[model samples]
Target chain A: MTCEDLDRRLSEGARAADLAAEPAVATHLARCPECARLMAWLLRGIGDVRVDSARASEIARTGLKPVRSLPPARTLIMSLAAIVAGVAGLHVVTMGADGWPLLSGSQAIVFAAFLAVTLALLAPAWLSSLRPGARQRVHPVAAVLLLAAGFPALAALLFPVRLAEGLAAEGVRCVAGGAMAAAMASGLLFLVTRRGYPLDWGRTGALLGAIGGLAAVAALQVSCPRHEAVHLALWHGLALILPVLAGFLAGRRAG
Target chain B: MASPEQDAVPPRTGAAGAREALDAELLRLMPRYQDADRAAADALVLTAGPVLARYFYSLTGDTRLVEDLVQECWLRIHRARQSYRRGEPVLPWLMAIARHTRVDQYRRWKRSSGRETGIDGLVRQPSSDPRPGIENSLQAREVVAVLHRLPDSQREVLTMMKTNDMSVEEVALATGVSQAAVKQKAFRAYQAIRKALGVSRREENER
Candidate 1:
């Protein structure tokens, strides 16, 4: 073989099997000083980069320290349970006099459908966080966009009546309450998932935020008496934006 | 062809064999380490430490930084130990943690110093003073210098492949890229190194 062809093969071999060149390549190198020199460089370069054994041992000694971590799956399940409990508790304490009219009719169906989509989108992120090599099929940005667009569309479809009387004054209270609920739920998620090193913090954060926002909306459905579409869309539907934005900022910093 | 005795490259099957043995031992010790068994943790570290140090050094050529990063990497491994699935390859998981540690450190440094420190900045020149075999050190340093010149993606793939002895699949998993992409990067890196070596050889010949 020509020197160029031999060189290419040797390089590929070296990249694949750090030390072992093919027998044919080794045989060729035996005769060629230039090729032998190149082989020497490649082998020695990789083989001779040594760590100070003493320091390595010293560092390894610290591994004796106790480290407590929960499995990612367990942590995710617990976080979900906590969120569900927290929302349920909020509903029990603050539910309106009408008492869960949204739970029985077309409203319940829409809520169930939205909940399914939310869980499906959030599952990959949670699974990825727990399992080191788990791949998230959807990109975080795309997930965020879908959540943003889907929330309003679903809300619009579920609650179509626009009351003549504007409830713009109540928007402040609704947003404030929703934001508080989301923050609490997001905090619990953050605490649980902290042990697992998420590769993409923004994605993790967005997922957590989305989960928190959904929890807040679920709780708000029972507590808020207003059934006006404009009120739900403006105040309740847009509630996820705060948590998502916050989650994005926090994920960027943490990840 | 010349006689086999004249061949410069030694048989390296022994090195690969030794590495695989260490990997097996590490896989065994990881669970014990998670359970806070001091002896097992130490054994695991002693086995995996050198490999991890080399991996970190490949990213940041600074010896001191590699030492620090190695310690940080071990701490992270310890923290994330419970999440590690049994029977999975340990090296890739460790390497993933190391990559995160390095990036976090770099980000913190950049924020604090307000200076742009890319991977190139991490490549410090190997010590100039000669110890027993200066030629070997020089060759290694030349290779490292050349590596620092490549794009970060190619350099990272090359380092994981050559320094850590990771397979294309392992590197792909650690890097969150496809196996094909890893192979492509490795090939590009090899080509770059070959071109650099060729140019240097021509320069020496001219001189």
Candidate 2:
């Protein structure tokens, strides 16, 4: 065999099996000094590479701090339940005379559908945090968030209303309430799942943020008597942005 | 020319079996270490320390730096112990963390120094001082020096394969690439090293 052909075969042979055991390569190398030199160089180079473990004992003596245990999945689920309860409690305390406007009729169905979608999205994030290597798929989180935010816009088309319903006046209160509720929920999630090694922190944070924002929106739906599409779209729909942004920031810092 | 098929023989299954057994044992010890058992932690260090040190050495070829990286890798492993699943293979998981730690350290060093330390940094200068008989061989030193000339991706794959004895699937999992990609990188790395060594040999003959 030509020198180049022998070299290529030896290299390819090394990848699949031991080069030394290849009889033809061995026979050729034994006769060819230059090929022998190359073979010797490759074998010795890999063989001579050695690691000294003199400091292994010293490093072991340094004594590592015990890793903190991840909170149980049950605790995370419970905390979520608590956040829902707190938001409901806040709604009961601050709700205006609109009492049960969104709770009745087709509005109730839409509200329930929104809550179901939000919970479904949030469930995976919470479960993933409790279990390492359980990464939530980004597509689902994005889809759910789009649906949750765009629901108001969809409603606006179905039920057109007068543009100036004084919804802008109540914007500050709605945003403030939503932010407070989101913060509470996010804080609880962050505390419980902080120890987790999320494969993607931004995704996790965004999921948690969505959960908080959706919960706040649901609470607002029950408390705020205004059924105006503009009120829900401009004020309530926009509140989710706060949590999403906060979550992205928190996730970046986490990793 | 003799085709490889004509010369190929059955691989030695005994060696493969032994390696599998060792990996299984290491996998078993990971949970104990996660549970805060100091002895388990120490044992893990002792068992995996040499392998990790060799991995770093293959990357940087700096003994002191390799030692420091090994320490840093262990520190990360300790911190992320809770993230490890009980029954999964430990080496890939550990290597994944070690890989990230090395990348982070390299970035930090680059940022601080405002300089890039690539393959050139890993190629050690021939030492004048007397060394141990076997290790002092000139051929081995020359071959290792040539390895440092490979690109980071190729060098990483070669190191994981040659030094750590990781399978393509394991490397793919650790490096977050497909198995086909790992094999391609390994083949490319081997070709690069062989071509470079051939050129160097020809240059020596002319000189």
The model with the greatest TM-score is 1
lDDT of 1 by residue, B114-200 (tens): 888675565566544343321235555666766776788888888877777677777777876677677777767666776766777
Across B1-207, the per-residue lDDT of candidate 2 in tens digits comes to 878998897544643554576587788777777666667766787678767866776677655666578878776676677777667777777787777778767766777878777634533553322433213345534644666778888878777776666777778767756667777787677667767777888989999
Off by over 4 Å in 2: A1-15, A18-163, A198-211, A217-238, A251-255, B1-15, B114-158, B176-207
Tell me the tens digit of each residue's lDDT in model 1 across A70-122.
55466567668677557646754864535376445878777767766766667
TM-score, chain B, predicted structure 1: 0.83
Q: Judged by DockQ cut-offs, is candidate 2 incorrect, acceptable, medium or high?
A: acceptable
RMSD of each: 6.9, 8.0
Which candidate number has the best DockQ?
A: 1
Reference-based lDDT, residue A208, model 2: 73
